[model samples]
Each structure stands twice: as structure tokens, then as C-alpha cells.
Target chain A: DVKVTQSSRYLVKRTGEKVFLECVQDMDHENMFWYRQDPGLGLRLIYFSYDVKMKEKGDIPEGYSVSREKKERFSLILESASTNQTSMYLCASSLGGGPNTGELFFGEGSRLTVL
Target chain B: TQLLEQSPQFLSIQEGENLTVYCNSSSVFSSLQWYRQEPGEGPVLLVTVVTGGEVKKLKRLTFQFGDARKDSSLHITAAQPGDTGLYLCALWAAGNKLTFGGGTRVLVKP
Candidate 1:
């Protein structure tokens, strides 16, 4: 069974505070993603990385950035958290890139509350 | 970015009942995926439909892709309490990004 582990299950941070959400995949997958799930907007991708040091912005990357310094570790960083950034954050990894890739293995999401 | 729409924002039914949810898009897709997410958990892939007019079944669940490859449907028969979750539909777009629709929240009462 492939496992994607999220470092934090829940976090509460004040506005303007810097925050870090970490994720690690044990399956040695090549593609990793960060997404924020909102009530009526669905899961909007924040960023994705296909290689260790390469990252790409997704549909909703305005308030977020990502780092993939290692093959198994991907981190989402918020330079300054705001109240509107409160949401459930999810990390996922897949085996390959492009249209023919396999299913995504997701972590138990990290719920962040910005006050 | 591809736009996908899921209908019936919420559904509630008793165990042994049947329900169906839909995902629609105007743009043709190379493939579509269905996922089920339990509370506090990330979405899990249930199935993928790649061909137009394709039909696939997993146990009591039935999935069908529209003939035009622009829509898909998930039908569950005799739904149990374990079936309660958020059902999400996603499109595998270019660059390996999965564009998702607003999910259908299903509650199956036992």
C-alpha cells in the first residue's frame, strides 16, 4: 500500500504568520501535488512538482509556493497566512506525468485555521 | 483549464436505496476519474473511464462515460452507510493535472 504522509493533521496560526505544511510519499512516485479544498470550489491545485527541484504553478497558486528538495519530500509554504487561507490542504503523489499517469495516492489532509 | 460540473450537490437516502450523481463538461476529455472522500480524509480514486461510451462496474457501483466523452455518471445500487462520502469527478488534463468538479455529498443512513 502506498502511503502519503502529511506532517500536520491540524494547525492554528495567526494572520501574517509564516506556515509550513509538509508531505512525504513512501512509494517513490515521480509526481507530487498540493491542493486546497474549499467548500463550494472543489479541490484547487496550488502547485505541483514533477522532479526533485522543479515546480509548476497550478490553477490557484496565488497565495502559495512549494519546494521539492528531495524525491520523497514536498512542502507547501505560505509566506504570510491570512484568514482567507483557512482551508483543508491535501498532498498527493502519482507514479508518472502526462495524461496516461496512474491514480493519485493522497495523504490524510491537513486542516489549517488562520485567525 | 478544463471546467467540470457535478450535479445534485447533496444526496441523502436510506440503506438499500439507489442513487446517481453526474459530472458534466463542455470540453471533450481524454479521460475522467471518480473519487470518494470520507470525512477528514483525502479523496481516493474509485475508477477511471477513458473511452467514450464506456461502462465499468465495481461491485454494486456502476460508472458510465458519455458517448461524446464530455460527461460521466456514477450509480450506486443498494447503498450502505459505508457509502456515505463526497463523490468527486476529475478530468485528466494536459500536464498531468487533474481538474475536479464540486463534489456530491452523499449520506446513506443505516
Candidate 2:
């Protein structure tokens, strides 16, 4: 079975601190995404990478950035964490981009709490 | 904003009951996906309907996409306790960016 692993399941950080959330997919997928899911509001994409070292901003990308230095790993960085940035962060990967974009394989998710 | 509205934000019923969830939208979608997410875990893909007026079934669950591809529904026969989870509907737009419905949380009492 394909596996997507996340660095942390839960984390706590002070407001204004920098935070990192990592995701690694063993399927060699060409697309990786980071999203924050909040109650009432569905999963809103923050960033997505279609290839190594290439990233694109999604709908909500103001306070977040991403890095895809390796094919299997994608990282989401909180430049400066704020109380409003606390939410359930999810990382997902799809096999490829465009016409054949298959179902996304998701990590267990990381829940961050900014104090 | 491309929005998909899901009905019955929460549903709770006995194990043997039957239920149906609805997902509606005014704008058309090229494809629709259904996902079931357990608490604290990521959402898992249940099925996807691409063509208009398509119907698919997985065991006791039936999914149908509207003729115009602007709506969809999920029906479960003889619900089980294991079916209790969050059901999300997603629509794929032009840029591979998916818009998801508000999601329905179901609880099956045993």
C-alpha cells in the first residue's frame, strides 16, 4: 500500500514562532499539497508542488510557504505563527498533474496549536 | 466563489436505518468525489463520478451524479456502526483545484 508520512501529529508553538510540517510520499507522485482544515470551512489549499523545487500558492497562502527540495518530501513552513494560524494541517499527494490526476493520498495530518 | 452545499450537517440514527446525503451546487463541475474521514485521520477516497448522469455503487452505498454534473447524492442501505464518519463531497475545477462541500458528520448508534 502507498504510504504518506507526516513528521508530527500534534504540536504547540508560541505566537510569532516559526513552525515546520513535513510530509513524505513513497509513491513517487508528481503533485504534493498542503491544506488547513477548519470547522465549517473545508480543506483550503495553501500550497502545492508539481515538481521538485517548484511550488505554487493556493487560495490561502499569505502566512504559509512551502519547500520541495526532494522528490519524496514536501515541507510547509509557517513564517511567523499566529493564534489565527492554528488548525488541522493536512498534506496530500497525487500521482500526476492534469488529465490523469488521481485520488489524493493523504498523511495522518498535523494538528498545530498556536498560543 | 464556486460553492457546493451539503445538507444535514449532522446525522445520527440507529444501526439498521437507511439514510441519504445530498450535495448540491449551482455551477457545473467536471467531476465529483466522495470521501469518508475518521476522527483525527485523513479523508479517504470513496468514489468519484466524472460523467454526467453517472451512478456507481460500493456494496451498500450508492452514489449518483446529476445530469448537469451540478449535484450529487450518497445513499446507504442498512447503515452500520462502522459507517459513522465525516462525508465530504468535492468538485474539480479548471485548475485541478477542488472545491469541497461543508461536509456531513454521521453517527450510527449501535
Candidate 3:
């Protein structure tokens, strides 16, 4: 089974503070993604990495950046955390890109609270 | 922008009841997937429907993709308390990214 693990299950930060959320996958998947799940908004992609040191901005990438220094690790960085950024963040990894790659396996998710 | 729409944002029913959730889109997709997520947990894939008008069954749940590959539906038979969770429908649009629906929250009480 594919195991995707997040660094923190719960976190709290003050406004304007920097926040970092980490994700690691044991499956050595080539594709990794960061998403925020909000009520009525679903899971909106924030950023994704296809390979080491490679990143792509998704639909809502503002105020957020990503790092993929290694294949098993993907990190999400918030330049300046705001109250609006308080939400559940999820990380996912997929085996490869193709018709039969299967569904993405996600971590338990990190719940962030901005004060 | 391709959008996946879900109906009945919330549903509450007693055990032994049946319900159907819908996911619709205006654009075509290569495959559609159904997932169930609990609070504080990420969504988990339950079924994946690839062919147009294809139907797949998993235990007490059934998934169907539209003939045009623009829509999908999930039906649960004799839902139980253990079946309570948020259901999400996702689509693979040729690209690597998977677009997900708004999600439907279901609660089944015994």
C-alpha cells in the first residue's frame, strides 16, 4: 500500500508568520501535489511537483510556494500566513502519468489555524 | 476552466436507506473516480470508471460514468452508519492533475 505522510497533523501560527507543511511518500511516486480542502470549495490545487526540484502552480497558488528537493519529500511554504490561509491542507502522490496510473494516495492532512 | 459539479451538498438519512450522488461536467474526461473522506482525513478512492457508460460495483456501492464521459453517479444501497462520510467525484483530464467535485456530505444514523 502507498503511504503518504504529512509532517504535522495540527499547527497554529500567527498572522504574517511563515508556515511550512511537509509531506513524504514511501511509494517513490513521480507526481506529488498540495491542496487545501475548504467547505464548499472542495480540494483546490495549490502546487504540484512532477520531479525533483520541479514545481508547477495550480489554480490557487497565490501566497504559496513549493519545494521538491527529493523524490519522497514535498513541502508547501506560505510566504506570509494569513487568517484566510487557515484550513486543512492535504498532500497526495501518484505513481505516474497515464491512463492506468490509478488514483492519487493522500496523507491524513494538516489542519492549520492562523491567529 | 473545467468544473465538476456535485448535487445535494448534504444528506441525512436513517440506516437501511438508499441514496444517489451526482457529479456533472461540461467537458469530457479520460476517467472518473469516486472517493469517500472522513473528517480530518484525506479522500480515499473507492472506484474508478474509465469507459463511457461504464458501471462498476464495490460491495454495497455502485458507480456509473456518463456515456459522453462528462458526468458520473454514485449509488449506495442500504446505507449504514459506517457509510457516513463525504463523497467526492474526480476526473482525469488527460493532464496529470485530477479535478475534484465540490463533494457531498452524507450522514446515516441508526
- Candidate with top DockQ is 1
How would you encode candidate 2's per-residue C-alpha lDDT over B2-110 as one tens digit per residue?
3889888899999999999999998887888999999989999999998899999999999999998889999999999999999999876556666578799999999
lDDT of 1 by residue, B1-110 (tens): 33999988899999999999999998999889999999988999999999999999999999999999999999999999999999999987777788899899999999
Strongest candidate by lDDT: 1
TM-score between candidate 2 and the true structure: 0.96
Chain A: TM-score in each candidate? 0.97, 0.97, 0.95
- Candidates in order have lDDT scores of 0.93, 0.90, 0.90
- What are the runs in model 1 whose C-alpha is more than 4 Å off? none
lDDT of 1 by residue, A7-101 (tens): 99999999999999999999999999999998867898999999999999998898888999999999999999999999999999998757755
lDDT score at residue B17, model 2, on the 0-100 scale: 97
* Candidate 2 wrong stretches, greater than 4 Å: none
Candidate 1 docking DockQ = 0.75
Model 3: residues with Cα > 4 Å off, grouped in runs:
none
Model 2 lDDT, full chain set = 0.90
Compare candidates 1 and 3 on DockQ and give the better one: 1
Candidate 3 C-alpha error for residue A24, in Å = 0.8
Error of 3 at A62 (Å): 0.5
